[model samples]
Target: MGKFWGKFLRSTAVICLLIIFAVNYRFEMKKTIDRFKKQSDENYYAMEKDVSAVNELLNILETSGNMYYKKNSNIGNHNFDFRYRSKDDIYVSTDDSHRLIAGVNKISSNWAVKKELDMSEILSESYKNISKVMPDIAYMYYASKEGFVNIYPEISKDSYPFLRNIYRLDFVKKELFGKGNKKEEGVSWSDVYKDPLGDELLITAGAPIYDSNTLKGMITLSLKSNFFIKKIDNNLITDFFIVDQKGNVISQMSHGNEEVTSFYDRLPKKLYDKRYKFSDMKPCDIEKIGKYYVYYEQCNSAPWRVYYVTDMVKLNAELLRGNVVFISIWLISLVFLYGASRRKAVVEDSQQTIEKLQVMLRKSDREVEKDFLTGAYNRKGFTKIASSELDRMRRYDLDACVIMMDIDHFKKFNDTYGHACGDFVLKSFVRTVVKNVRLSDIVGRWGGEEFLVLLPETDYKGALLAAEKIRKMVEREVFYYHKQSLKITVTLGVATLNVRKTLEKSVEEADEAMYSGKETGRNRVVGYQDIMSKDIKWKK
Candidate 1:
């Protein structure tokens, strides 16, 4: 009986120790999790703050650079006055130079060239002042509408032949003189181009010169790729670079004799393997690769993305260091407590699995059907749903209508406000339309800034009313981005399905009507019937 009493006492002591271990283990685990969560939030906020600061700096610089041209290019008379003269009056003719000259002259007014304004001293002094302010500016120059270039801190003539007739290049033809470009007031940012002279990547920022309504010439500033990298390379937690909307790297720091322009070859495989529709990426979304965390933020004034990459292995190392003691204690406790907790853990696991399954089922439809950018229907999903509804309507001989709409001056908006604002505008547009339309109506993204609304069981008049409501809502909506308010408008075309028209043909007719509205004036809705009365040649 004494032996049995001793065994009972020892068992009681062991059970007491187990309970103590479990409580301590749970407390430590909670503390560790809370600590890490706090650290993670701090780091995330720090990163976001840094990104915003850098983005703001870049925006200010670009804005100032553009304003420099607008203010300086209106020097004197409307004449293309180039004061800097070559040391030797040596002239070389080439097909490229001739084409460039012709391109520049094509945009110039009929006014004769005047030698009256000698702004050489002004140009040289302005360059000196600008250099003091912006040391990264490698070169500043002015080009005449006749293809003559006056470069500050002049170099030998043999070094830059292309500068002599810059208008011949596609950059001049497309960016500066392209259709729908407001040449005089607009600034153009060149893609990363290989510099023939230095064999390095370079980007040119230019603004057109204007006298009243005529294109006189342009002022340009060139910066090396390294110059941009230096501006934001001070951070240790993340490394970032600029990329265009198409995911092509614009300017990045070169490494160890690697060619800076070999973006597709040298960039992360993930960037090249899949296209980033950027529209789908949220501001706080962190994409995880094998051992890296990728974050991107859009520039407020450019159609470019600033991508930040952090090494997850390095991040985890910092996280784990703080939790070592807790982890060890937890592991030891787990061995002793497993048998006691096994049944309870099994029940919890089952419950968690069922809950996860239910959540997955609910999210699957949204994942499959929604557009990544605007949360609208993707093209394929929309087409399928719309076609099915159209088929059912046809069988019942019910009336249905569709509208095609596009944001007016969207490209201009992007150029002026930056791609980030463009994204904001798109989301706002979708939200406005969705709010005004019936819940039964379907809105889908047809393409960039283009949307299609499927109005089931609605007539042509109803569709027009819906379209007009959307148009007015967009115009009246105050779009706020980065503390600035912007106004935008849309043009919509309405068409109703008839027994004679297929569902696809009805969509096409609506698209055509939208184009007609665009041709006449934007921010208005046009009905297909209105255009059908006229002999209109629709663009293929």
Candidate 2:
């Protein structure tokens, strides 16, 4: 009976202690949530103001943009040369125009060029006129369905490459007004996107021009991503993000030096995909997703959603340490400090997870063309990019060359050493090739132990010199496989792309020339045109 009584008392004490802990946890969580919600209210107001300001600014640009098209549609000649062509065929007239920079995806008739250039000039004048009055807009542009794009705000002589990048932007190709959805009526907004040539983040408001029910082009106004970010971000408060309909970030607050990427990757899929239905209502809060307290507002004006995320881990413990909540303040403070340290660790791990998501995001698109092992272009990617560049070379009457090289006795490395050593050799070989090539040049792994190199503005002689230099460097470099040392040589075939031949034909020619080198001598450079010099007969 004495033992039974003792056991019962101890059991009762343990159960009472657990109940106390449960109550404390509940109280603390409620207090933290209440405080977080209040802060979110302030954040929502600030962000709303920011969005409104952006809309207002866009409205002014829309007015200016409309005026450009409102003017005469008739073509006017200002003696802009139709005979002029840029080297890459990516740019048209950049240096000549002081206030307007022009680029084209491909050249068209002189009549079309005159028409595009004339409209571009009018747009440039409108941008210039507006700047004198309202110095608010950073830049304005017009993108035609044909290929022409005029970016106002004069690009310098050497900065023409930047203009070309703008012309080749994905938005220019597909979503001129963020037209992925094509939801809005006029002056639709582009999903926030980063500049391919630089670090600057930008979003565009574009108004499409229609000619009797046929879609023409768009007049776009550019705004920095910060124009939206600066409004709601407070380091002491919640983190903010402007997410598009597709869960792409339009703008975001600084989260240290870590780059902000796809928002869908950061949160649970259902948050944007399913869970709560977003309506054209007031800013609303989502109680919790995982550990984050989220609130969002769908902009009635724009097709994007604004999010405020409150990390429960970062919440202050002032409420838990208050006189009403705690009898021993310092003791509670010590416990809170300990908990905060653990939460910091959780936050660090979360950041590492986010970094991994960034890699996953890149894999979805960019990696489709990328080689998994070597980071070089795979066959498909190589074919696409090389074909484009080759077409440009042929059309613009510029010079380029192709080099098809294969490892001499590459099978020996795999058979004798092992596939691991073979892979190491292949990786090392690619490194050497890439290091020897110019930044403008492209290298691709056509297949196992065989690679393709595209050199822009390179003649046959230059291509041969480059190939020999690559061969000599590769021959001299030592390879390591554990204790054993190995060296390898490459047989390269050179072919010029300036001729009126397709990319496939040129690649075939280069491949044949490489085979000729293998037939004649194992480790030598050979040119397709000089196949007659060798005994091997190459089919034209």
Candidate 3:
């Protein structure tokens, strides 16, 4: 009877100890879980907003293109001065010397150049006023397959050859243009990149321009790559960061000391590989990998999984710091009597380490400065060196001229035959100019049916002579096609830049002369000097 009574007392004591273990640890677990839940929720909404902002930037670009298509047709030239550049838009150009004023808004036979002014205006406004729409947007750009990259909040050419480098990224080809991605996910975060200007990492989210299922180009916006990792608090989450799908840790310092970075290396493959187990819209998951207690959740905005990890042994020691006697009694009760261990303390790490994911993107081949079809300089390539050539002319007090040419009624050919025949005629026209002109003269496709010729060391008369020769040759050449032998004529405008003036003013004068020829007969050569005849005249 006495032995049964002793056994009953010991049984009651064991039940009380079990209750204490569940209560103490469960409270700690709940606190950590709740904290992680709140942080993840905040990050999810922020990421959604950022990705949405990038998508909106594409809309702005397309809207501007549509606006250009609807511009006033009667206006001979769409002159948008860059000096009156809006406060909101950043001025980005291949030629920094001409950055102060726009010199190339000239109307051509094609709609391509005319709309650049409208795009520049609207893009600036989008960047300036979008502060109200999405205040966190610091960088955004539209990268056209036509070889132009328009970025807001001007980037440095020395620091970042943005136009050349941006086109060569894998993200631009695959992710933005939709090869490996589902259509429902309209925009997606790119693998992070090291910012050229700073130590920080950046990520891109953008959409591509598709015309009836044909990809035209892409537009993108950028934000910090640590969007998810920033949610980790050093005091609360000592070993917290984000990892890519491959389990590479993207560690960035979140206003903490630099010493913290070297503390933890890459995250284990065992953890990130198990990311699928943490279901979306579910509770924060708690897992033990080796000696570490890991809490994790998936990010909705970026292609990353966020994690909070701490050493289990260290956490228990810290938790038992204040409850020394209670923990002692609890440990003794469990180990000596019950043959169980006390609930290990649920606590954070003693020191914090942010693991940064350094994404090394291979520089794609950047051989796009020249025109792909015609082999002449495209506008982008021409603009890169045109300014320096003119500056040299000015420094030497030598004569130089720019000739603007356009094929008269070129669209009728595209309408009559298919676009293929029209493309053939353009190639032939370029061939004739390159064949006849001096080796020093530069030829470039200005836009649509419009083309440009740079005459170095030439007066208006010399340029006119050269322009007339090209005009006569183009008038004579026969485009022998299988369907029909087609004939075309070109109008030429010449402007002399011996007098001091901006390139835009000279190009504007040249464009004006070209339009005059188009207005009169369409096969003649006109000189800006002969028309303007002001203080600036034809210099020999």
Candidate 4:
């Protein structure tokens, strides 16, 4: 007997250990699924915000380009190109208009001032348009091939003299005369460069200006690097940055040093050695980099990528906490199970009783709520269910409609056939309607031959469509009683809920319309508005 008991104890301990392992595995799986869900949501919202910002900036650029185009069309024939003259006649050698305007340069200094004023007015308009959208624009200026810069609004007398040769700036040489700018007709962004005036890092957006087919000049909008950083820095809990195609850091949400130029340089040696380029990174791709997990997304409007980096230390800690708790629970359960093995029969009996009581309670609740024959909600249950649904719709400011329907001449059919046949028809009709409506919609027996359907988030137009579909479906359904084919049709009325009325009032409106449909045509759907209009038309 002692040997038999020892074998039994070994078997029970093994089974309990397996149960603990299964529980721990299931818990960990659930946690992993939840973590991924949260990560996906975070990535989606982050991408959406940055994409919207880029799109808005693109729109501002397009608007600025159109302004320049209009100015060119209005003033191209004026021949005022010689406003800025050089001893070398550099512009004149390239542009024929420069020669034409230079021939007439002896006119007057007043005419030259007028031409400058006209150009300044055009620049001012462009500045106003862009500044209104992006108030933090660093500078709005036009750079001409003649090495002239027209800074808008008001350029200080000290800076105006120095800015005249801005065409020599690296931004113009790299962005305007660069390889990508030659073929692309759209706006182009320059890599971050130090502002000569303030020594702050800034980026430029350049839109090319053309004279018929000749490249003339460009309208440039400059913005400080902090424009991108400030918008996102304070909101982020983890490290986030924007990087160029070459893995050069364009802007970071919160970097201690503005001097950190490349994203790859900041990475741990192990990660940098992997040679992961920014251009190759896909949207929402997460990669393990040393002790960190990095997520990146490609911008739709810019040739840049956004990255979010999370430290794996915190994640490991959370996993450790979960495992520790799971082990502690397993240890406690092991001891409890060993002690309870002697009274397993009594415990099993109690568990069975609890389950039986739960089953009875569920059946009792179901019986109270459900219709005996149709499997739909009864009047009391439907009122409770539909009112809750209506409350949710109102809370969310969503559109919803209630459809009231009745079988045409249902009482007459019941009298002709037996009660059992009538019951069969009701069940079949409800079943067909249930299958036709959306899963979100609710069907309930509103007593006798009438039924009510609550369609959440459906507008008046959608509800009308739904009611028409049900009307046609009911007309087509062929019910069979005994060996003979039976026919039945339903009239429906739809009323959409609005701020002006309550849910009950909407249902009353549908009920009235349903009666109206029966009075006019036995197999049709009528909206509450239709009945109201017909009544008014009859009175007239």
Candidate 5:
């Protein structure tokens, strides 16, 4: 009888030990999987940030270029070789009386150079015609080292000479020889190249002067490419580079010394081969390149690929490590509880219940944070995250920007089309916004037709430029439904958190600027400073 009792007790003890070991093993495996999942999630978020920064940077570059172009179109013609002394000697002679012969001549000698002139002659003709037509004659000159010389009329030569020389003329070095002004050379021109004649030039608009396919020289109607580098160097944080189809490095914001191989050099070989299907947003780990969160969009129309790359591991490792620590603590606590629990049945049941509850809570949290339609952050989620960011900025004394956007005439579209169309429009809008916004920037559906974006470590000017880009992208996207095409436009209001007294103030300022955009024109971007200067009252 004593031996039977002892054998039964030993069998029970062995069974219990086996059960405990199995449960603990399963739990540890789950923890490992969960750890992987958590890492993946953190990586995903970091990738998002990287992508957003790229998009915003591209947008800023594009918008600034556009603005510069609009401001000074005839930038190349600002500086002309005008014989100031031989003003009286210059006679408007032509093949016919109706035509005029305008050529350069030496002031000291009577020897007149009949069309021994550069491309500026054509511009001078145009200016002459304009002066004949208009009462007031203001002219500017943009001298080129080679190719067509540019001429502008009705411009303040003193003020915009440098701009004209740098942007429009494509002059490598410009020397302004004036009485009072010291000879100014090597001055980096602004991206916003403004001609005295009110023409704007874009640095990106590289309109080359080709002499029958042989690259003699290039003509730019905007700032020099070097100017772009200097500006980017001054403002942008992330490393930026412009690459051509042959993988030749055209320009770089930083990290230019790195070899320029194929665009594939930046991406995995598999991704390079399958370029068409490659995701614009992906986190890739490179050995010496470091962990880069890369986003690239091929310019099918242009001979270029616009890409943004950042060191992902270095930027977000701290956050990821912190998250891992928290998860490790939770797992350790669970393991301790499992080891200490004596009642096997009760313990298993309790562990299962806790796990289920934790899953439920996480799911609930995700649902609240994510947009139902697009799986992006909702307004509330954006606010929460933005608040956290604001706190961080305040603590760190960092820069940040916010952009407010609204669909143009969305109400009219809803009225003209059905509610179904409206929903489609909303979905389309969200898609475009998501596609354009930087992964670092927070984009959310603020309300029905309104969206908000938070750009960390950016200034008001940059935010305004970013908003303009989003507006342009939304405008460009073709929305098709049932063989019907619908064009969409948006108005954006930009404000910088770096400038505002408080986060609330920034939001309010941005909101007001957005309303101003609505009032001024439906499709435009209004800066917060402009709104405040107007003293218009509004709320966020």
Candidate 6:
């Protein structure tokens, strides 16, 4: 009877110990999960904040560029004297040539000879008023039916002889134009030259002048690209570049190497042919190059792309460090709990609990870095992965590319079909994009309606093919909603990252190329280097 009682007592004690161990293990697991959830929430909020701030900066720069161009256009229309340069040698109408008598005895009644009247003087006088109002005016020129006339005092005859020929009102030929234009108009930006001044690159703002119900000539406002670049206050540490549709670097603001001109010119020919349909900003990391966040916005009614990029490593490292420290504290708390727990069964349970907690913590970390919707690395996740990939590529001298894609008219679809349908489209897009890419490729949801695909061991040619395949797949895939079939298309930009290039620059170049695609049309891929090779001409 005493033996039976001892056995019962021992069994009861063991059961109690097991129960206690289970309870403690459960509690610790719950605590760890809670801590992870809280940390993840905090990290997500911080990432959102960072994205908003950077987006705001980009918005400001975009707005400033628009405003500057608008204001300049308005000023040009209101202040400048519009005149047509004649192709034929004809005397200016005496009535039209009459001078205002402010201090003179009488108004000049003689017909102004093309050569007799000081063309430079008339232009200088007309531009003097403009200079007073717009101090940023480096130079202005008026092309009439007769010849080229320099309106600004700063311009010299020796520096711009071509201005005379360009002002001689002639019909635009199709052969000299880019792929898009069949016929060019009189008042267009197409006739503008970059290397005209012989010293620095210049962008011309041209407007055709009308007289007597006829196209007389055109007026051009030549300003250095530097003037526009100066307006953007360099806030982020990333380099800024303004690229034309052809991928030519119009202007760049950077602290790095300067001898990289014609960089985009080196892109494969196949990529250049289809570069005018892509448009989106994408974030990515390059191993030794660092982290990059990029966005592209097109100028209204222009073929230009304003590409903005920032170094993400420097920007987010501080914030990520703070989160890491917070995580460390939670880990230390878990260790303390483990040490305090006692009992062999309890210890075993606690070990299992710790293992589960560790797994949860690791998963939480992944979630924080990954995009919830697509399961691809989020912007943060891309940054981490890209850095590593870039390092691997560089160390082994491998080729790789980053492709960015955005759905065309995505907002309109969302507005018309509802958010649920929009989500379906996004998910469908991710599936299609992933399927079209190689297993070695990494695809991520870059942000709202945008995605980035990292192609390792691929050159520009390979990247372009992949981009084209994905573009076609997305275009062909149909999304169903309430028995209605809907099709969606996307624009893609591809840029290769090589040993000499930084990841930020590569992404920016790709973004610029993508926007060029958007400007031309949708459902196409654009290679950064390819577009830069040819001079892209825009029709009025």
Query: All models: lDDT?
Result: 0.60, 0.66, 0.60, 0.64, 0.50, 0.53
Q: lDDT of candidate 6 vs native?
A: 0.53
- TM-score of each prediction: 0.47, 0.45, 0.43, 0.45, 0.32, 0.35
Q: Which stretches of candidate 5 lie over 4 Å from their true place?
A: 1-367, 534-540
**Candidate 4 TM-score over all chains jointly:** 0.45
Q: Model 6, 299-335: lDDT tens per residue?
A: 3223344444444454444333323433344445444
Residue-level error in angstroms, candidate 1, position 144: 1.3
Q: Write the per-residue lDDT of candidate 2 for residues 1-540, one digit (tens) a residue.
A: 997887787667656655775687678667556655555555555655555555565565445444544655665464454333466456555246546545556546566456555665665666776555434456677777666667767655456556656656666666543444333335466666675435667776666654334444667777766666555644334577777755677676654213436775555564556344444223344556655667665454566777777765565443433223232433444445334554211112445544643543342222136564576886757888987886787678898899999999998989998887888888899999999989999999887689999999999999999999999999999987776999999999999886587788889999999998999987999999897554455442
lDDT of 4 by residue, 1-540 (tens): 997898798678869798878887677644533453245335435544544464565556545544555554442233334433344332211232211112112223354333433443354455666677676677776665544455544443244334534555666886456644344456667666666545566667776655334454566777777666554422112567777655667677557435538887766576678655544554546666666666665453455667766655555554444455455556666657556653222123445544643443342222135664587876656778877876776687777789999998887667888776888889989999998999988898886789999888888889999999998998998988776688889999999876557878998999999998999977999999888888899999
Error of 1 at 391 (Å): 50
Q: How many angstroms is residue 136 displaced in model 3 relative to the true structure, after the best TM-score fit?
A: 5.3
Worst 10 residues of 1 by lDDT: 95-104
Q: Candidate 5 lDDT, tens digit per residue, 330-418?
A: 44544454455533222234455456535533622221356544555766578789888978887888989888888888877778877
Model 3, 303-352: lDDT tens digits are 56666666555555544553455566677765666445555543333322
Q: Looking at model 2, report the run of 10 residues with the lowest lDDT sum.
A: 359-368
Model 1 agreement with the true structure over 1-540: per-residue lDDT tens digits:
997887787677668766876776566444433333333333333433433443443344334434444555443353232222244333322322111111222223333332202232234346666666556666666565554555554544466554534555556566445634344454566666665445565666666654445554556666666655544432223455566554556665444222444444545676545435334554434565555565644443344555556564545554444345444554455544434543312113445544643543342122134565687885656888887886887788887888999999999878998887888889988999899899999998876788999998998888888899998898999988877988889999999975567878988999999999999988899999878766555643
The residue pairs found clashing in candidate 2 are: none
Candidate 1 vs candidate 4: the TM-score winner is 1
Q: What global local distance difference test value does model 2 have?
A: 0.66
In model 2, where do residues sit more than 4 Å from their true spots?
A: 1-35, 56-74, 77-85, 90-98, 105-119, 125-139, 156-170, 175-185, 210-216, 235-238, 254-260, 267-283, 318-540
- Candidate 6 or 4, higher TM-score: 4
Which candidate leads the pack in lDDT? 2
Between candidates 1 and 2, name the one with more favorable TM-score.
1
Q: What local lDDT does model 4 show for residue 185? A: 52
- Rank list by lDDT: 2, 4, 3, 1, 6, 5
